[model samples]
Target: MDYKDLRKEYLKHRLDPASLHADPMIQFKLWFDEALQAKVDEPNAMVCASVSAEGKPSSRYVLLKELKEDQFIFFTNYHSRKGIELFETKFCSLVFYWRELERQIRIEGIAEKCSAAYSDEYFNSRPHGSKLSSIVSPQSSKIESKEYLESELKRISGMDASEIKRPEHWGGIGIRANYIEFWQGRQDRFHDRVCYTKTESGAWEISLLAP
Candidate 1:
């Protein structure tokens, strides 16, 4: 099979700089709403990339829990590899690709932990099984076997729901974006790219890039 032969043209939509919102957050919401209307699966899923202190980079897909006026939020274990890296570097990138819509968004930002109150609120709202899993799972850590995890999960599940409070090791991390780029695929590979960069004076500078 020829791998290079498995390409398809992307002509579903076009992005215009003039049509973008002055506020990147608002623009993101507009596109996010369109994605929802288009029935894009897991539209809030994004690839989060972080680098360790020694410059080793790692990336994984995570759900975008909440989008705030100043930042994008996602939750995870504080001791996880990505969490540790994010806290150490305080810099990360997020990528969202919606194949069904032939669009993508890239964001570079600073990482910060969300407030404990917010974390607790979100945790309490989660499903019971998810809550148990969060309490028992030592994410990114090696364990003896699957049985160990199952046992731990079972143990946690047996406890009273009210007793299962949010662990201090698990919570939300917010990314304050300094740069964001929106990409819309087009015919003949001449895609459209619009970039928003935050300036030192707290203003956004928009620009177009050649595709």
Candidate 2:
């Protein structure tokens, strides 16, 4: 199979400089709304990239659980590979791509742990099975077999909702973005790129980049 042939032209939309929002967060919300209207699958799913203490980089998709005034939030096991790296470096990048809309958003940010209270609130709101799994699964650790997980799940399945509490190792990470770039696909790969960088005075400076 020739992989070079697996390509398609982007002719869906074009982004205008004047149409961009002064605030990157606002711009993100606007695109997010459009993504929802376009019926993009899991529009809130983002690729979270983190670097280890040794400068090794890794990425994985995580659901965007919340978007705050200055942060993007997601939850995971604190002991997970990404989580450990985040704790160590506190530096990360998030990417959101909506193929259906021919658009992508890139964010560079600092990662911080959310309050324990907030984590508890979100955890309690999750489905029963999810809550159970979070407790049983030692994320990013080696496990013996699928049967072990099945057995663990079975043991905890009978616990009532009140009995299930968010474990100490499971919580939310909020990323405070300092730079954001928005990309819109155009004809012949001449894409539109608009970016926002935070200034020293906390103002956002917007710029257009060549495609």
Candidate 3:
């Protein structure tokens, strides 16, 4: 199969600086709403990219659990590769690709761990099985086998839900985006890309880039 021939022509979905919300967060929410309306599976799932202090970059898929005024939130094990990278550099990027809508959103920013209280709240809200899994698995660590995980989970079967607490190594991270890019597909590969970057004055400046 010819890889180049696999490409599909894009349909124009133009975006302009004037048409965008002054607050990039609002714009992101609008796009996310559209994605939800389109019934995109796992709409909250996004690609999280982080670079180690030594400059090695890694990316993995994670779910976006919350979006606040100036930050995006997701949960993970603090000792995981991405978490360690964030701890070292505090910078990361998030990318959301909606293939059905032919749209993508990219954000770059500094990340910080959310408060312990917040982590506890979110953890308590998770399903019983998820809470048990979190308690049993040492994320990013080598496990003996699937049976080990199953056996560990079984041990917690009769535990009371209210007694389950957030693990010390697991929590949420919030990325405060200083740069955001919105991409829309167009015909003939003339895709539309708009970037919003925070200036020194703490205001955002929008610009268009050639695809």
Model 3 alpha-carbon drift over 4 Å, by segment: none
**Per-residue lDDT of model 3, residues 1-211, tens digit only:** 9887887877736766678998889999999999998988999999999999999999999999999777999999999888899989888999999987889999999999999999999998998888888888887788778898898789887888777888988999999999999999888988889999999998999889899
| TM-score for each model | 0.98, 0.98, 0.96
- Model 1 scores worst on lDDT over the 10 consecutive residues at 152-161
Model 1 scores a C-alpha lDDT of: 0.94
Off by over 4 Å in 2: none
Relative to the true structure, candidate 1 has a C-alpha RMSD (angstroms) of 0.7
Error of 2 at 146 (Å): 1.8
Model 3 scores worst on lDDT over the 10 consecutive residues at 9-18
Q: Residue 209's C-alpha lDDT in candidate 2?
A: 96
User: Considering every candidate listed, which one attains the maximal lDDT?
Assistant: 2
